[model samples]
Target: MLIDWFTVAAQALNFLILVWLLKRFLYKPILNALDAREKRIAAELADADAKKAEARQERDEFQRKNEEIDQQRAALLTKSEEDATVERQRLLNEARKESDDLRTKWQEALRSEHQSLSEELTRRTREEVFAIARKTLADLATTNLEEQMTDAFIRRLHKLDSAERGELESAFKAASTPAIVRSTFDLPSAQRSAIEGVVKDVLAIETHVQFETAPDLVSGIELSANGHKVAWSIGNYLASLQKHVDDLLNVPPKAATKAIAPPEQQANG
Candidate 1:
């Protein structure tokens, strides 16, 4: 209003200087402190998140290890059961084999004992029968029986077949020792002369004959030249009877009765 230009220019210069001082000292310092606090809080949050992730990974690894241990335990149990079953089967087989072997041995032992008993029984029976027959024949022997036996021996020589005659003749001719005539009893002079005459006539050769008394002949007469022999005896008949008895004893009881006569009846006949 008064036309004072100098006073107005000085006041405007003072206001500009005040605004620059406020911005440089007060506003700039406060803004820098707030930015530093925000940076520190962000760094703490990132560290907490990294720690939580590591803990989760460790938990997962522990669970996997527990599952693997469970599988290993199950496999071990199955293997043990299989092994037990195999062992049990092996034991059963061994027991069965032993039982069969024992049974077989028992049967064989029974068969062997039965065979031994049968053989012993047969032998005893044979000895007793032979003893009885020998005693009976010996008691029945007589001088008349001896004479009859001598006559029978002579008849047998006369009835010889061609083969027997030739064998006897050859033996007599080739003999280095004299022909022997044996009897259970001594021959009477008449009987001896008859025998000598008959032998010479039948053979048509001059032959030396020796006589022998043999108690074992059992009412028998025998003539032997070299290895050839002609004989007649009650003992021969008894031996044939014994053979038949032996055959009967070997057969079963039912069959034996139908097969042959009893030993006593055979002896009497």
Candidate 2:
């Protein structure tokens, strides 16, 4: 090592200058670039973390919306099922009511038809019985029957009470035309004379007489003065007999026996 103080001093100064230049131009610029790159990388990492959090929130929200839609669909299905059940019950009730109505109408129609048929049968039976009775009586009629009827008429006129006699008298007096004496058959002169005499005696009115034959009387005498009438007929007896017979046939056994007993007793008496 040489001991040269002036030369050493100059070399040391040169080495110091070189070290300052290297620090200012090379080391300082490299350090600043590295620091700027690290700051940029940190900012990018923070932005990536924020975007990841937002994506997770959107995924959670979509899941929740799907669950809500499922609940709404279930509720709608339940409501539709309930409506269908109610509608089915309403239709069943309406059908049952209509069935009942139809059944009632059918029963009523049946009853009406039965009643009509029964009434028609009863009417025809009554008419036939009446015709038979008329024919039988006409066949049995005779001169003796006529005589008896005439005599009965005369007796009835004689037996008239005061009120009936007065009514006949008033009718005869009010008549502008002759009083009519009608019978089913013509009468003999003697019977007519007798009837005229009895009318004059009982009623005490001198009235003209008109004797006429009316076959519709069946076996009867009918006298008409003004609007008043006096009549006696075998048809009345026949009608009473027919009614009694009808009652006996139509009634129950016990009732028929009791009804028949009365007529038999009356006839015997």
* lDDT (C-alpha, whole model) for all candidates: 0.75, 0.79
Where is the poorest 10-residue window by lDDT in model 1?
Answer: 141-150
Every model's TM-score: 0.41, 0.43
- What TM-score does prediction 1 earn? 0.41
lDDT of 1 at 103: 85
Candidate 2 per-residue lDDT, tens place, 1-269, comes to: 67788888988998898889999999899999988888888888888888888888989998999999999999999999999999999999999999988889998999898668755554454445445655665667623555666888988788888898889889999999999999877988888888888788878888878899986564579889899988876667656765775666579987666666877686885
How displaced is residue 228 in candidate 2, in Å? 1.1
Enumerate residue pairs that collide in model 2. none
* Candidate 1 local lDDT, 225-268, one digit each (tens): 99898887666665666568667667898676655878787688
Candidate 2: list runs displaced more than 4 Å: 1-143, 252-269
